[model samples]
Target chain A: MQMTWREIVTAVHGMLFGGFFLMACFGVLVLLHRSLAAHGGSEVKEHGRRRERIFLILMVLLGWAAVLSGAYVVYPWYRAAVPPGVTNLEMYPQRLLMSDPHTAGWHTLGMEWKEHVAWMAPMLMTMVAWVMMKYEDGSEEHRRLRAMVGGFALAAFLAGGVAAEFGAWINKKAPVTGGRVITLSQDGK
Target chain B: MSSPREAVANGAAGAAVLAASLGCFALGVLAVAGDGWKAVAGLLTFYRPTGPLSGVSTVAILVWLATWFTGNRLWRGKTVALGKVSVAAFVLLALGLLLTFPPFEDLLLGK
Candidate 1:
């Protein structure tokens, strides 16, 4: 069976979101473990470091997937269908791309963030992971680096969630129909 | 026993792993952002369509290989400190991520 362009976009977008959501959640868990370790003593902290390392690896791989998938969807697939003289910014206006008109202010703000900030989670987390790898488990410096990376992961999670919502919204709002220019509301309402 | 010079050379190779890893990650960001010159230069994929992703992935894979090769020799069992340079580099990278985001752009430009 032949899948429609919309289906393809949707599937890829889903992968991007799923990967990011899992990574972000994992980042949070790592952070929580680290915080508890600060007070939980040496043995507990050692366990936290090991877990954090695994989570960091996972986050980096997920990040790679998210970035690559996002690029594939936007650059080659969606843009190919975009008409001449139309930029993504123009096709999907920032107001709509950033936020939903039907949503409350905070929800809109939250959505807006994904377009701008969500990509940073993996980059920052990877740096933290690399830094942590150099130091042995349960070291003071390792904990500090873990906390920092965890904080970035949380930031990424919020942005990634927003991005996933936007992807879903766009899939419905503007699908690629054959030989026709699709026009969607600037606000996606 | 290895000479002191050989030991220093190995340490440098090990350090290169961190640099390569960070470089690959940064290249990935450049791919997403499509920052003109860097994106084009980094485009290893050669296919015009999927250039950004291709370039980013190519660079990332190459860097990871280098890191893996050097992993066994890095730090010589001593503690690794990121030091001021590494810290500053990370901060700059984080700021780049934030600044390039649409919301951050709007926030900064009074949009």
Candidate 2:
């Protein structure tokens, strides 16, 4: 019935990646729609239209992938713990509590996943923006688009990397151990 | 009436600005890869530990400023499309940082 911290961490990792993937997919969709409207025209070249369509499809697929992966990561825990009679919404509070800071494994997992989502979402969004700008028709608009997307992407990449590193440092300095099963404090002192 | 020499000088100035902006953009990319300071500051408002986050933020801000200045110079007096895009990008970056940091955390949390 009990799960190891490693297993929990792995699940959190999956969730984080999944969340980012989903966020990216959404960003891409937004970019695609905007690009299609802004750049599409009667004079649209065949190449431009083709590229636009490809981006649109790609964003949709990535979004779905993130949703599926995210569900896969968290759903198992939900299914195993929740009783058949109880609905997910009904069991949500307990599940959330179980995942709180006091429970080391759950806490670590939650924190890790949150960090992952934070990093991934912005990074992916930046990438989507970059790609949209890249494929834009070589107009004044295109140049502006590139600068906007590139600037944001650059910012996100910098910010996310720093946050992740900081989180890692904290984890190392104050390692969390679940329950009272193991304690290293007594030996050192 | 502007002479041919003046036109050439103006063209050269524009070229120099573009080149400088491009360089800054490249530097920003490198900083992001290496976990630069601005990146750190942007993310520190979240659950990040204090030390490294501050360091990275310091560096990232410097780089961002350098890039912005270069970009502005390159765009000259005109509101070129590229200039607008660059402004938008900077705004988004600031927004993202805000969302991740303290005051904006509530917004990100759907609170």
- After superposition, the stretches of candidate 1 with alpha carbons farther than 4 Å from their true spots are A1-5, A15-37, A40-59, A73-75, A81-120, A127-136, A139-141, A155-169, A176-189, B1-45, B51-53, B56-86, B102-111
Interface RMSD of 1: 7.3
The local distance difference test score of model 2 is 0.40
Please, what is the TM-score per model? 0.53, 0.32
How accurate is chain B of model 2, given as a TM-score from 0 to 1? 0.35
lDDT of 2 at A174: 34
What DockQ does every candidate get? 0.17, 0.04
The complex in candidate 2 yields a DockQ of: 0.04
lDDT of 2 by residue, A40-118 (tens): 4534577866775565455444433433332333323332344567654323322443544664433334332333224
lDDT of 2 by residue, B2-86 (tens): 2332211222222222333333343333323323345544544332233222333344335544654564465444333344344
What lDDT does candidate 1 reach at residue A148? Answer: 46
